[model samples]
Target: MTSQGLHLIRGVSHAVFRGQHDDRAEECSFRFWRCGKGFEISVDGRDVNHTEFHLLWHQLVDDNSLQNLSRFDKWFRLWSEWKTLRDVLHCPTYTLKLAKTGTDMRVAAHLVAGPVDKPAYDMLPVHVSDMDNFAKGLPVCGSESVRPGSWLGHSPGPVRGPDGRLYTLVLCEHRALDAQRGEADMPSWDRIRAYVHLAHSGVDTHCIPRLSSLVTDGGLVAGVLIDHIDSGSSVQGLVEAAVSAEQLLSLEHKLALWRDRITLTVTTLHEHGITLTTPEYGSTIHELNIEVNQHDQVCMLLSFGTVSIVVGQAELEHKTSDMDELRTVFDERLPELIVETRRRLAAA
Candidate 1:
């Protein structure tokens, strides 16, 4: 059927671009929706650079439609045969490329979750203050807490300012400049090194859906994207300052631990054909890069130290790399981190 089908994600808001699996990947369009936010995506259309949004769809798609094609009609019959032959199916995702303006265009159907699942997170007082400060500055970015807020995780009651404009900070993360969150036990070195850029509080980490795939234990794992040209996040600048701060040496123990995890990651990467070898870490800033060969294509990278996994890219990227080797690193080691962290807490 030439006509595309749509799937509705109740709380996360948006109709999935359930389209015909054919050569015209560009023809597949999507509608993104969420709390007071909405947009559409397609080739040469509006906002082509929303890479993460496309990722969210690929990682989280409602295939309930798979059961609805009951008609033995010719259209359904033809489509069924095509679906059965597809070795790898995609859910949905966006990839922003350089537009005519030299800026990346977000091209994807991405929407905010109406009854969004903004989970509670742990945070420090100092961090919360920064998030509040950022919210005040970026009047157009994300929704801020009504009164109280945090240094980690999403806030509540995102409202359109009386300015009568509708804008949302896609997704952001709030943690230390070099901090990362995942199943706590042993940090997956390669995964951690995948995305090294730190996020500010209140910045939607799911901004572009980069890290939504691999961590989908129950569909909560996703990474945020940042619109550098348009943002209200002090976290980016703050992360830079934190890294180069000589005082950061005071947190040496934490840094050393992070390095240990990172080192293990690099070694493992080498063992598999993936190369993360690059720039010396003389500076505190993390400019790490993860290069992997996917489907015979070399040097596909994401942010270093980013512990996210989406299905599409990985299918193409890791298809040639050592998947078992990589998965073993996280699968076996993550549990260890969880146990050790608990032990430390118990002793304390």
Candidate 2:
């Protein structure tokens, strides 16, 4: 069951953003990883001639000094790697077109070599069992189980790196063992992996999870090491717990802060020609992926999976749709939460 495709890199990373705290001590850990040639990447794995994608994110957006030229220069370096890989392998230019589905998405990979356009790769559906196998086989992180980030399910492993930083490991949708016994309504890792890369390549480090590695089993993506947020839970979790009127009111400033953070984050993504879709629950809580700091400030926004890079008019129109959805999520949900909290308080 060796996959000759992309995979996620195992383990966690402790990323320190520059110029945060006065003593350069205002460090927050984020996740990032690179793709290497293997069926499964080890914790100490390194991709030859490959740069960490998340580092590129930090370099581009975290620093205020970088100009548009600098950003282009940064992307040029990354494009060089892809170009080299393509040239060395004599591989055709692959255009992976993904379309949405009811439960998962369909990936249509086409090879282009000067007017010779044809199908290239198989569109395999990644199952949760494959993710479980990926987690079970990876080297155990210090002081944690094989599936460490299992709290959120879908087989996210927890790892405590040598640097003592915690991280959550997820199965990359692009690569894994082809399950003989299929699971129903399985999520697509192909789209998920693309979203992870987009988050690393599109958004800033503060508003998104740091991707540590793109772990692969030679060709397919096997697993991914992402930042483990040890901060407070999602705003949905906070609202759900607010049973008193006073407690709900206390969330006013926090909600405002979160809304502002999300708005800015979404706006920044849009500025980069990317659009993020809103969650179904009007919240990232459906995935419990949003992280709030102890001070009730949003450290990271959610739904990296929903990010789409705009290209033409159709995609551009999506920006307006996405923005409106986000506005509704942020503006409308607070009042409902307040009302629910008051009802709970009165009932008690």
Q: Give the number of the best model, judged by TM-score.
A: 2
RMSD (CA, angstroms), candidate 2: 22.2
| Residues 1-348 of candidate 1: C-alpha lDDT, one tens digit per residue | 122232334423222223332342333444332222323343331333356444444333333333232232223212111121010011222332322332553432233323322222211111223433433322221122111111112221121222332222122223433333343321232333233222222222222212211111122222222222222222222222333334333323433443344445444443333343222211111322211121211121233333333345553444334344334333444334434544554565
lDDT of 2 by residue, 38-117 (tens): 11111111211123432442343343432332223222223222221112122232222112222332222232223222
Query: After superposition, which runs of candidate 1 have C-alpha atoms over 4 Å from their true positions?
Result: 1-249, 278-301, 304-348
Cα lDDT, model 1, residue 201: 25
lDDT of 2: 0.43
Worst 10 residues of 2 by lDDT: 36-45
Cα RMSD for candidates in order: 22.9, 22.2
Candidates' lDDT values, in order?
Answer: 0.28, 0.43
TM-score of 2: 0.47
Q: Quote the positional error of residue 323 for candidate 2 in Å.
A: 1.3
